[model samples]
Target: MKFIGRTVVLLLIVNILLVYMHYKQAGDVIAKDSGTPTYQQEIEVMNRSDALYIRHHFSGLSQGRHEIIWPEASADRSCYALDAISCGRLDASLTAFVDGDNEKQSISYKIPKENSESQAMLYHEPFVTLQGATVTSTLFHITDETRSGGMWVNGLEQVGSKQMDLIDYTFFQGSGGVQDLYWQQNSLPLVYEGEKLAVYGPAGHTEQFEAVDAALKTIGADHSAIVIDQTSIAVQSQRFIVSENADIDKASTLFLTSAMAARYSIPQQERLLVEVVASILGDKAIGAEQSRQAYDKLIVALTPEELALLKEVVNSKAGQEMNATILDDLIKEVTGFKTSYFKTAIQKDTADHLFLFEDTREVRVDGTSYADIGIVLKDGKSLYPAKSILSHLGYTVTANEQSLYIEKEGRKFRFPRKEPFYVYNERKFDVRTSPFEVLSDEVYFEESWFRRLFLLTIDKTAETIDIVNLSTVLEEVIE
Candidate 1:
């Protein structure tokens, strides 16, 4: 037994040593060429401030030529790119490098003291060294409101004995919800002329593409001759450029200019005015008949003073410059003429001694029109259809004989039939009015209940009730 125990102990010790040796060999291989770069890029975007700081580290380099490209690098007379090796004023693009020595190198750049518009910062490395290399590219984006920031990394490739091309990094920063949906649609692959081409912006605005296509079609431009995505719109053999962040009016004007330039030529000034006007009318200006109708509506809606202001602005230098802010102001002034579509309507009927009166009002939820869903008007109160609205907002709504339950993401609500109180999560709360059954499967509650429960904005007009979910609009709804 002692001999057996001694043999077991010796085997355990030998196995442990062998395992340690194997790990050591693997660690050595990892240390030599683990595909991870020796250096990294760090970026910090200060909260509630316009300050941006970026640091780049180049630790393990061979004695050879290497380069770093920063596409978003820009400098004024006061600001410049700085490093231990060299410092220079940056132009639209910055290309910095180290040569002949293998010492560790780094660079740091800071934006100017003044506040600037939010932008995208991109980093690229394209070079070869004696030792094999791994290239990493990063993009940092900051929103204009400074409310949010994001970073993305890409182009991780092991470069062995061959140079790398400049990595393409597409960065998109957009307000959430419908805007995000549009961006997603724009990013989809578009097929044109039996060929697939990727679109990247600083260019095409997807929303304006349909209108531009319609106008082009009216003017004898081939329907398939132009292709558009959120990034850039290609007109057969030509490419038109518009900023991804361009407003509807500006994007429409630029697209119209491009389309006209490709096919039917138009005077620049006249085209600008026409495009701005069409864009202001939105999709209503898609065809000639709709354009005439939109024009008539605009004329009828504008007051004499507003008309004079519009004319003055259109003839002024700002209008000639197609200034976005000024055009936005004009749009705000004319927005009353814009049409609103509703999905459902509530009909109220009242009976008197000798007469019957009936009234109907349209309803909209979150700017979406539902033709089949409706609200109920009872005893001078607006009663909302609980299940339809909640379900439409992506809630799971279930009902029993006694109570109705609603849940979405993590929020929960329960209302006992004919009760003036509701339970949210595990907590109960009182309400001024109770929920009641209008039909076998339909239950209705006062508008205040929905407003309080869902953080909705209820805008009641004579002809319509606009129920906008504040959480969805702000893109802050719980997951």
Candidate 2:
């Protein structure tokens, strides 16, 4: 499903993830298979010579231009590269294509009814989304992405507003309990910045987030309980990411996805939610009571709240009394089923656990410590969640997100954004290139290097470092 991990503090602790297992779906299920791409197909797909045409079958051509799209079906089996011929769904101006490009191509299709014998899955009546991979203008220019298995395409710069779809799926071990639940699909139908993941999983269909939200509401404290809190992002990178930051960006992606769930989406947008999250799901499998206990423990630790407060919230606010109606809607887009899904090492007393949100949109400065938070109410200010901030700092804070960075009085520490930042045993070394967060006028790091730097520089220069044990300092930082 669309995964959204964020920190949400209920009026009380009425929070927990709505994890569910899948039993047998109550309908004649549609089947699907992953398509393959060939070298020849690849050349055809990348053939930019043609105004690759694409138009949605369901919506038909808007009052705009249309064209035949490039195909990507042959690049790799079961991959996301759209076959140039099937590369449908191009973004439109709602006006005709200039230069006689408004040619007619058909892809008017939508999810089929359960009983409909006609093509019901995504592959069947596989509608084409014009401008499927076509990049557009945006503040955050997306260059490319790490697609399933391998690269989606070469020379592919990521961007916003690309035509996309969602897939709803459940991982089941025969008649047994659910093993995994995933709602794979593109979160943004189009975007201005950031890599949009193209997720088309087992259930080749988009689900109704609104319905899932409603179902979630029904499960509130009365049926179940859940409390969510704000999240602190931790970014760690192994190598310098000049063009992109993989590990770091992944954390930020989760953060943004969670934020999206916190906010509701419109009908058109809501279709992106996966099936499990779109509706009240599997109750016929697994140990509900046992699973519930595990879930409770997971959430309680996530909040790091006093046991008393945790008891109060889950017992009352989240105790099926609230219905978590808002969260239900949230799951439509930012869907997370289990409490563990939301739980992350948001921070630690070290920088090793930190993650980056953006590679270039933001910057980092040398510091001994810091905090990271969001503008909840926009008082033109926001409260820095202690955990969120300290985790970003290299301090010995309670939770990693709320961790701190401290060093010896006379020692100095240094951390950089690029790769090969440190050195190895003999040559220069490398460190997890996680960026720290700034909050409440402090830089927090969950990894050791950033923390050591912050700690050592407590009273000394924030820039220059002591030269006596350069190699030693680097070695200590490596581990």
Candidate 3:
């Protein structure tokens, strides 16, 4: 009997060992699979290569040539990379070798979508021809598609009875006389000569001003005056002067020049500028208005001279020529003036303002009242009846002895009755004000809690506490 019992115990031990080994083997398989790079990761690597190719080669490509060489193994992934890099502005056609001997294939991408349709119609062969024994010709042509009749080209000999638009004719005729003007217009010029600093570009091109300003500030050129001009708008300090033909279509030159000029600016200021630029660039996930507000606040702290320089650039002819959205971006890129925590910090500072109302205020949800209880104004902060307001807004509100639970659809929020933090998806976030109970039944929450959790807008007036549903506001906007 003792031998039988020992055998049973031995079998039980063996079974437990087998179960543990099975789980360990399964876990190892899962960890190995997870360690392997995904298709998305491979695609991202290809995309980076595609972006580098475009950045280095795009501008240097001859007119009418936009071909990119990609690895044959990932040639099929070019479309995804191009779309992402260009933000849907560009599309490509893959051309693979029939023999498949080469490791690389060529993918030809089309021009931006806005220009692609009219491109073929706009440019025709043999519009102008040049032949000479001793005469050398330099041609410059620019088309401002956003404006009506804003095209101009230099050194185009008109063919018989072709009848080109008057706006198409270049303002200056000869190469010798307008060479400096041509260079200034075609490129970004940060030229300083004899107490006069000249930056040539659109007034809306803030980057040009930023680079020139940083350079000047670094060199302590406080006595110098800046001359900024384009074709239609010109703003100059009393000491500086500008010519008539200094107009340009290129804003990209400012980016290249600014990168080089940043070396001359103060190192700490340059680092701050880089941080601001990164913040602005990364702010697409937030909103453009947030970035604009941050920029506006930053400029307010600039010195009078700096402000004047900014105003000149923003109100110039070249600035007026740019799209409003593009102008906003340029304004946000203004750097090297003052250091301030931009968007995120500014938002927090603004939100810290707590108001105390003297009069009794009624709660209005979407401009209408669904509950009889008014807002509780305590300690200079407005608190709303949480259960009543949230229930009307389609959220189920329940309370236990220690915590309150608010849920909508699949989303759940847990607020500890005594703690100054809320839990969402098991993640705790500290808040400025903690939720409290009234009369052992009603739960009151701060204005920020509603805004943060549900994106509701709270407008406080003398007589009413207006709680606006953002979706309803958007619908009204759409109408």
Candidate 4:
């Protein structure tokens, strides 16, 4: 019996040793050695303020690059409203890897309901890197605001081969909802001035291409563009150049030569191309009819020869067939024009605040319009009535003593009266104009609120306000 007991004890000891060895091996592979330099830092922003919590881990080193995995479970969130407490949660899953050389990086992330089809991937290997480029960002503004509060880092820390910089943007907004964590890397040159694409179009059509290019540039994109003559166009093996040789698979803009566009089967690939361009431009690209109209304006300005060529290309038998059926499809694919189907142009009443919603519904608010069909307070800042606009946008609005809440689909927006800021999905942001105010039993909010919260595009000269739901647009983009 004593021998049996000793045998059992020895067996237990062996199992314990085996488990410890396995864990030790895993630890070595996962992290690095104790001497490995591991540090962390965080930047927090509350519309602008900060708080940082960091920890460093050093274990035994292994082969391959280090992987940074994000939390997959729903994170708890809390907010205060009207002396009451509210709770909500948001789910996200993201992973990133910084190559051992520290010069390359890749990220894969899923944005819960915002994106579900597949994970988005971004890989960077220093495109146009400045030799001594610093990673400057609006995050520095956050650091400046929080420094006096003693919640910011006064020093820097480098982890592994890559540096650790965590930016936390907290919207000190009103009541409970999901918060958007926006991380924009403004490190590249011309990050703010914008990027441009070299446009290659049919020969002798510089004025035609220049018109469209200038319009896009005025909207803060495709800046300093070069309109190249297609016949003698120089093809640089690069990204973002709109030319015949451009890889459509990777290129965002496609410049369809007259011949190539003619070869497209009516109502099929041509429509697809328009859709692709609209998806790429997101908010900037206009619809087919609008594009056609813009093209018409450009043609009117074209020289006799250029105009003649355009008419020839457009009035050809192939163009006739495409224009008859496929033109509508192409126009339907534009991102921001809700009035594409309307035959008549929306007339702008600049004197009064008259807004044509989708060129179908017209609303003449008592207040003046600023920044176009949006709203402007009599005080010179922009503001709008929540019920008047939200009702038109298919949103259900509820009224309370202290605030007005508007909801559409699964999204919610809260505008609190007398507050300097408003909350969307639980995150807060500062409002240039007062978010909500009660005048004669109506709730009023800033004109920019709807645009900022709902992602709706407002066009002043066109006198049109796009009410198309952005989520629906995104779903279409996904499809």
The candidate that achieves the highest lDDT relative to the unseen native structure: 1
Query: TM-score for every candidate vs. truth?
Result: 0.24, 0.19, 0.24, 0.21
Q: Over 4 Å off in model 1, which ranges?
A: 1-359, 418-420, 431-437, 476-479
Q: How close is candidate 2 to the true structure, as a TM-score?
A: 0.19
Instruction: Point out where model 3 deviates above 4 Å.
Output: 1-359, 431-440
lDDT against true structure, model 2: 0.24
Q: By TM-score, highest first, what's the ranking? A: 1, 3, 4, 2
Instruction: Compose the digit string of candidate 4's lDDT tens values, residues 1-479.
Output: 54344333322222222222222232323333333333221223232222211111112212234444333322221121212211111112222222233332222122222322212111112111112111221111122222222111111111112122443222211111111222222111111111222222222222333344344344332122221222222222112221222232122222222222333333333443332222222212223444444344333333455444433333232313443233323332331222222122212211122111122223332222223232323344445656666666678889777877888876787777667787778889786766555643556655566566766654443543334445556777899
For model 3, how does the per-residue alpha-carbon lDDT over 1-479 read when each residue is reduced to its tens digit?
A: 54344333322222222222222233333433554211100000101212211111111111222233343222223333333333222233432222222221222322222232231111112111111111122222232323223222211221112125432222211111011111122333333322213333233323333444454334333222222333433321111223222221112112212331232232332322322332222221111334334444444444455555554443232202232233334444443311223322333433122221222456788877644654655566666778778777788988778888888875789988788888987788997667554532457766776687777988877667788878889999999
- Put down candidate 1 lDDT per residue, 1-479, tens digits, no spaces: 54344333322222222222222233334444644333323222222344444343444455454445432332321222345442322222344343545345545554432434323322221111113343222222322224332322121111111112422223321110000001112332332111111223223234433443344334322112121233432111121122222133334334443443222122343343343343232322322333334344445545656655665544332213343334434534443322111000001111111110112456678877776565654456666777777777888878888888888877988888777788988999887756545542466656776787778888878887688878776785554
Q: How high is the CA lDDT of each candidate model? A: 0.39, 0.24, 0.36, 0.32
Error of 2 at 124 (Å): 11
RMSD, candidate 2, Å: 23.6
How many angstroms is residue 20 displaced in model 4 relative to the true structure, after the best TM-score fit?
A: 99
